[model samples]
Target: MNTKFSKLSFTIAVSTAMIASASLASPTVVSFSDATATSTSGSFVADNAIDKNKNTHWEADTDGASITARFGSCQRVDDLVLNWYGTNKYTYSVQLSKNNGATWTTVVSKTSGKGNKNAQNVTDQAANAIKVVGDTDSRLRIDELKVNSLGSTNGCTSSGTSNTSNGENSGTSNPSTGEVSGGNAQYPADVLDLSKWKLTLPISLNSPPNSNKATEIKQPQLKTYTNSEYFRLNAAKNGVLLKAIAGGARTSTNTAYPRSELREMQGDGTESAAWSCTNTDHGMYLEQTLLHTTTKKPEATIGQIHDSKNDLVMVKYVGPSFANGSTDIGKLEARFNNDNITKLLDSTYKIGDPMTIDTAVTSGGNVTVNYKNLRSGVRSSTGTVKMTGIIGSCYFKAGMYIQACSKTDIYNNTNTVCANKNLSANKYETDPYAYAEIEVRKITLR
Candidate 1:
């Protein structure tokens, strides 16, 4: 304890203090040379070596033998860094295996030549055991090998200082953490809109008007449902839930009847007198449900009637028929292709009318249907029907239904007798006409 102690005593005191401070200040950097070389029965040789800069480190030499450093039983190192000098490019690939090297997966492969000393980061989305494999150029030397954990660690905190592991800095946080955080997190623009959230619309909205003029005049304009608005509006307020009714007629009579009477009798018995006196009116009705099975929304419907002896007629009838039987109707007709109709029906028509032709094989073919007569009318029986041009191959389905209702009175006074007696005296003949047609086709992409 004397003020001037011996040199040995002074040196020992200083050394003791230095050791204690070093232990508390930093983690002990255990050089690979100090640690025992872990040996396995495999071809890998684990050893400690000094680098060209005299840095002590661990090394795995696959020099003549393949070497791998295994971690614990289940998790293997995912990344490694090697320091070496070499000539004649050396190619090596990193392999990984979860099953103790039973099956190795190649993660990274690189070639190094003279003046090559760098850290390589090996990342494998799927890897368990990480090691290096040498290619044709076998003169390989690895000065240092460090393993790194692959995925993100949830509840672990790394020492604040940068530590090189798997050739990447592994620490609690990096200087550019803010940039990384901002780049990874993003939200969609429409997520905040509540108006777009619910699929159903409010009931206060109005339903749209029907496209059929005959149906429109007899039906209230407000009462008629429009396909456009019906989806959002409540079904009860839309209109009457009536079945779809449609038909066509061919008459030699050259007179254009007034529109008012024609709209009143559409699909009903009000025009029995006119229907019986003329021998030329003919048509059919094709109807389906309005709402789709998946959407439950009002949708446009299509109807087609094929007459083998006449022309194949396809009609797209909009709702809300006219009071005067005068409304714009979309019609298409063409000569039928027996083969094409068969295939279209086979694919879409499951429950409806069967196809007259086999639709399975003839996917590409031409068909035609002629529109000999077309007309818009208000009363059920009397309206100006025009003859439209023929439509060909416009429809995917070919087979449809056609029914003929003919009113015949041998005595020309049938109309007068019915008016006076108020009795059903007109001779009515109904017959089912058979024609080849395809089923309805869905225009949705598969």
Candidate 2:
């Protein structure tokens, strides 16, 4: 007789208990250990933003200024609250970094703000550092900054701390990414030394004159630059990703395929890196995985030893060939004589499988290649190419060089659609999404 009343009572009691539990779950307030600003006004300092006093404020010296705060350790931040000092609108972005300030991940971006206070939810985000970069005709001002963190965390540890005041850690430039020093260099620039390489992008400006040329980055700028589409750190922040699409820009008119690759560079990244394969041991060691290849061709060159005109040796992937009943799919082949290849590396390799490859020319000019599959235990080598003559002025190249291209690719259609003689505004995209990607974990050259 009282069933309905009994159910309503139980529901009320459950709701009350849930509300009580929610009220008991409180967030912890995080404090900053140090703060720095790109520019600061006379009386307003970067520390004022985190001082917990709404009366004191931090003001930027100019537009496009940025302020950074370092936590004692990494933290799982739940939310952030910024109290503005004035009614002036500001366009800004919030970025988080786990490795000091070397790399960053944008968490919140505001193109324009009209309110006096802004709160952003960043739950479960891990970061040891935070930065606020703003652009406005009027200087940006922050009265207070607050962060709500999760429970206690040990956070990420740096490999080594910097002793110099310049903020960069002490170490030799990374061979891969060329990062001078950080906690660790485990991802893209994981080998060789980045100071000795340059990056080539499969993109260019569309406007007249130089539109036909691919973009290249070298030296100091290459050390910290990353392009989201062509080259960037993987999600795990432990590998470098190189991508190329079917209709992207080519390095030159004669090149049909586009590539997001690295070329050997010399001192300070200003000169091309070239050396003779005589009296010196030249080699490159790579740890990488092929992530994708165009559906039509399913082929890409991941590593190469190149001369001025031709690739002497290349680690190429051959997708399953339908003509052969698809038996040739996932084969890792070593290419020589520009076209000749040997499937001695791995006949049954699968995409996303990690592999280690070692290609070298001995001091005596004898070439050698070795391969090992980290997961399947498959291994093979080419021993040496039939060295007819010594190769000189050669350099090492790594990253993705997609072997597929569309008929509209720069090389094929330079007349009609591409006739303006002006560079395409961006990378050509004949087959949108038909692309190749490689995760370069490590690359070492000697």
Q: How many residue pairs clash in each candidate?
A: 50, 14
Per-residue alpha-carbon lDDT of model 2 for 134-181, expressed as tens digits? 777766666666655544455555433211112333444433222334
- Local distance difference test, each candidate: 0.23, 0.63
Q: What's the TM-score of each model vs. the native?
A: 0.21, 0.54
Give the per-residue Cα lDDT of candidate 1 at 322.
Answer: 23
Among these predictions, the greatest lDDT belongs to 2
Candidate 1 deviates by what RMSD? 31.7
lDDT of 1 at 218: 23
Span of ten consecutive residues with least summed lDDT in model 1: 6-15
Predicted structure with the largest TM-score when compared to the true one = 2
Judge candidate 2 at residue 330 and give its lDDT: 78
| After superposition, candidate 1 runs with Cα above 4 Å error | 1-45, 49-64, 73-80, 86-88, 111-115, 118-128, 135-139, 150-446
Question: Per-prediction RMSD in angstroms?
Answer: 31.7, 21.2
